[model samples]
Target: MTAVVDSAKRHTLQALLSLPSGIVRRLAGRPVEIEGNILDPEMQLVLTLRKIEGAAIEERPIPGGRRALVDAAKAVGGDLPIGAVTDLDIDGPGGPLRLRFYTPRNLAAVSPALFFIHGGGFIYGDLESHDAMCRFLAERAGVRVVAVNYRLAPESPFPAAVDDVEAAYSFVTANATGLGIDPDRIAVGGDSAGGNLAAVLAQRATRAQVGAPPVFQLLIYPAVDFAVKRPSRTTFATGFFLNKRFTDLTEASYPPAGVDLTDPLLSPIYGDLTGLPPTYVVTAGFDPLRDEGDDYAEKLRQAGVAVQHVREPGLIHSFANMVGVGRSGPEAMGRAAAALRRAVSTP
Candidate 1:
C-alpha cells in the first residue's frame, strides 16, 4: 500500500477508537419511533449526534446526508498502484443515475465486471465516497468495476432506490456489447445497505426474467431485514460505529411512513431467495447486523443458492468502509476483491 493510504488507515482506526463507548452503546439499542413526524426532535437530535461523530471521524457527506466515513482514514501502509477512472451517467427509473467505471491499466479484455453499490444505510453515500475502494477492487481483482450512485432516502423511498438499481442493471446488461463487457460475467456487490440491495436485486432479476442473472453477489456486513430480530441486534446493538439509533433514523429516512417493514422488497431477508445467484456473505464479529447477514445467507443456502459466509473477528460494523483508516479496512477489501476474482474466474 502507498504511504498515504497507510496514514489514512491509522487515522481512521484512531478516530474510531476515540468514539465514546457509552454513546455508541446507547445509539445501538435505541428503538425506532414510527409515529408522528418522521423528523421528530429526537430523530433530529440523533442525526445531529451522528453528524458530530462523523465530523470527528472526518466523514464526508455525499449528495444526501449519506456520508462515507472512510475518505479521511489515514493510510497505514504502502499504496497499491491503481488504474484509470471513467465517469458516466445512465438512465434510471426516475431519471439519470451517475456511475463510475474503473479499469486497471494491465487488465485483459473479457474480464469480469463487478457492479458495486456503496453502503450508507439508505440515507447517505455515493460514488465519490467510495472512490478509492472501487479503484482498489478494479486493480486488485483485475476486473472492470461499475459503481452505481443510487438515489437516497427521505426523498426517494424504498422501491425508488431498488427501481434505480434494476434500471441501472438493465441498462448495463442491454448495452454490454457497446461497453465491451461480458454479459455472462457480471456480478453485483455492496456493503451494509448496499448489500441488502444487491441481495434484493438478485431476487428481483430472477423473478422479472431480465437478462441473465448476476453470476455472484458479494455482501459485506449487509443489513438484510427490518422485521425479524437477530441476536446481534441485542448483543452489539449499542456500542459500535453503527448503532440502533442510526439504523432507526435511516429506516425512517427511507420509507418516511406507511411502508410495510416486512415487505420482501423492503427487507429482503424475508424475501424468497430461491433461484437467486450464488452469494458470498461477509459479517463482522461485533456487528449488530451480523446475525441477519448470516441468516440471509442461510436462507439463500436452504433455497439451493450456492453460498459462502466469512466472519471477520475483532471487527465492527462498517469496518470495510474504513479502508482509508484502519489496518483491517484495506485487508477486508483485499479479501473481498480476491473473492470476487475467484467467483468470476470459476467456470
Candidate 2:
C-alpha cells in the first residue's frame, strides 16, 4: 500500500540520521571530487545521511513532492521558536498571497525588515519550509522578517513569482507605518530560486526609480544565470544536493518553452547591476551555483554597488537550510544576518 511504503521510507531515513557521524560520512558515498576546495567534514556528515535517505530533488505527483521536500528540511533543521509570529494575506497578482512575520521578543519601535522568499527550486518550498530560517534571521539580526508564500512553477510560472515578490515588497513599503517598519530600511532576500526572484525584484525597483527601494539584498547562493551553463555548473553538478536534474526541472516548469532564458527579469546576472542596493551574496564552495554567485557579486561591485561576498569553501549548496547539520551552516547564516542588520539599520 502507498501508506506502507511512505511509512517505511520515513523509518529508513530516521535510522540513517541516527547513525554515528563517522559512519554517516562513509555512507555518504562519494562525489566527483573537485580541485581547489575540500568538502567540509561537518557538511559531508549531514549530506551522507541525506544520500542514505534517498532524498533527491525529483518531481513527485504534484503536492506529494512538495510535501516530501518540506518534511525533509524540517526534519533536519526545524525552526527555532520566535517571540512573536503572525500571518496575514495580501492581494497578489495571482491571488491572495500568504506572508509570515517574525518579530523579536523585545520589539523595537521601528525595525528594519527583510522581505524573504523561500527556495525550493521554484517548485517545492512554501512558508512552512523556511519557517525556522526566517525566525533565526529575525532573532539574530534584530529585524522584522516577512516570508512570502509566492505562487510556484508549472502552474504559476515565469513572471508569476516575480510579480508576487514585487507586490509583496510594495505592500510592505506602502504599509510600513502600520507595520512598524522603516520604509527606507527594507531589504530583499532568498536562497536558490527564491534568490533569483530577489535579484530580479531589486532590478525592477531600480528601473522604476522607486524612492524607497530595497536598501540591501541578501542573496544566499543565488541562481543568477539561467540560460547558459557556467563552469561550476558542470564541475559540481551531481551529489551536491542541488543537482542538474533539479535545475533542469525548475527551468522547464517556470520559463516555459521558447521563453528567453537570458531576459534580465529571469536571469538578473545579465541585467545592468548599476545603482542597485548594497548586496551581500553567499556562495558555497562546492555548489554548482558557486561561480555564478561570485560573478554576480563582482559585477555589482564593478558597477559601484557596495558588495559583500562570502564563500564557504567546504560547504555545498543550500547550506543555509542545513543549520542543524553543523556549526558552520548556522555560523555562516548568522554572519549574513549580521551583515543585513548593519546595512538596513542605516539611513
Candidate 3:
C-alpha cells in the first residue's frame, strides 16, 4: 500500500508539473497572498501536492532526509543536456573530495568557471541532487561549472566544509592554466547553504586572500544570518515547502558543539562585505530565508560592493531546482543564468 501510494504521488507530481499554469491556478484556487506577495500558482499547486504526499524529509532521520531530497530532485529535475561531465577526486582539508565538472558545448579556449556549492542545509545535498541545475547553468551560461562535494555536517561539522571549499578554490585557481580556465574570471555561487559558502568565499578572497578572487557571486535564497528570526521566518513559516521545523532540524544538525551562531564564518552577513566581487542575490518571496537574503544584498550594497538583488516575487525557496517543472521556476532560473553569463563575460 505504501509503495502504491508513493508511485501514485510521483506520477501525480509529474502530471501536475506538466499542466499549464492557468489550469494549475484554477485547480489551486485563490492565490496565497502574504506580506504583499502572491505565491506563484504553480508553486501553490506544488505545495498542495506536497501536503497530500505528507511526511516531509524533516520528519525523518538523516538517511531518510537525504533520500527524500535526492528523490525529489530526481522526480522534478529533468535531465538537462550538457556538453560533457567529468569527475575527479582532489585533496580537501580533511581528506579526498569528489568534484564534478559540467562543461557546455561551444567551448572557448579558456572559459570562465563557476565554483558551485550544493545546498542541503549543509547536511544532505550532493552532486546528484543538484545535477540538473548545474547542467542547465553550464549549457545556458556557457561556463564550466566546478561543483564541489564538501563534507557534510555532524560528521564533518562547521569548519570542515568551510575548509574544504577554501581548499577546492585554491586548488582550482592554482591549476587554472592546466585546466584551461581563466583564473581571473572564476565566480563562486551556490543555492541555500551553498549560497552561504559562496558568499563567505567571496568575502574571504579579499579578507583572508584565500585564492584567486571570484569575479562575481550568485547567492540564491541564501541564509545569511542565523542570529535573527525575521518576519519572513514567521510569515511563511508553515504551509510553505521549507517549514520552520525543517530549518530548525537543519540548524541543529549542521553546527557542532560550541560553535557561535553569529560568527562571521557561520553567517557571512556579519563579516566585512567591502571589496567583494560583483554579487547577484536571488530571493524568493515565499521563502523563509527571503529576509536574510535581502539584508545580505543590502549590506553588500551599503558596503560599496556591486550588488544586484532579484527577488522572484511569486516563487518559493529552491525554486531554481525545478528546471524541468512548471513555468515560473524555469523562467526565474533563466534570468539567473542570464545574469551569471553577463557577469562572468564582462571584459
Best prediction by TM-score: 3
> For model 2, how does the per-residue alpha-carbon lDDT over 6-125 read when each residue is reduced to its tens digit?
455445655665577677556655533567777866667566666666546584666777887777766545547678999999988988999889898787888889889988888889
Clashes of 3: 0
lDDT (tens digit, per residue) of candidate 1 on 124-187: 6777667766777788788898889998876788888888888788888887757767888889
Relative to the unseen true structure, what is the C-alpha lDDT of residue 33 in candidate 1, on a scale of 0 to 100? 31
> 1-347, model 3: which lDDT tens digit per residue?
65464456556766886787688889888988987888888888878777776598888888888888887876566767888899989988788988899999997878998999999888888999999999988888899999999999767788888999999888898998688788878999999999999988888987757987788999999988877889999988988888899788777877776778889889999999988888999999999999999999999999999998999999998798888667788889999999899998954
Order by TM-score, highest first: 3, 2, 1
Which regions of candidate 1 are displaced past 4 Å?
1-80
- What value does the lDDT take at residue 211 in candidate 3? 89
RMSD of each: 8.5, 3.3, 2.2
The TM-score, computed over Cα atoms with residue i paired to residue i, of candidate 2 is: 0.90
What is the overall TM-score of model 3 with all chains considered together? 0.95
Q: Quick one: best lDDT, which candidate?
A: 3
Better of 1 and 3 by TM-score: 3
Predictions in order: lDDT: 0.71, 0.82, 0.87
Q: Which scores greater on lDDT, model 2 or model 3? A: 3
- Worst ten in a row by lDDT for model 3: 1-10
* Model 2 segments more than 4 A misplaced: 1-33, 209-211
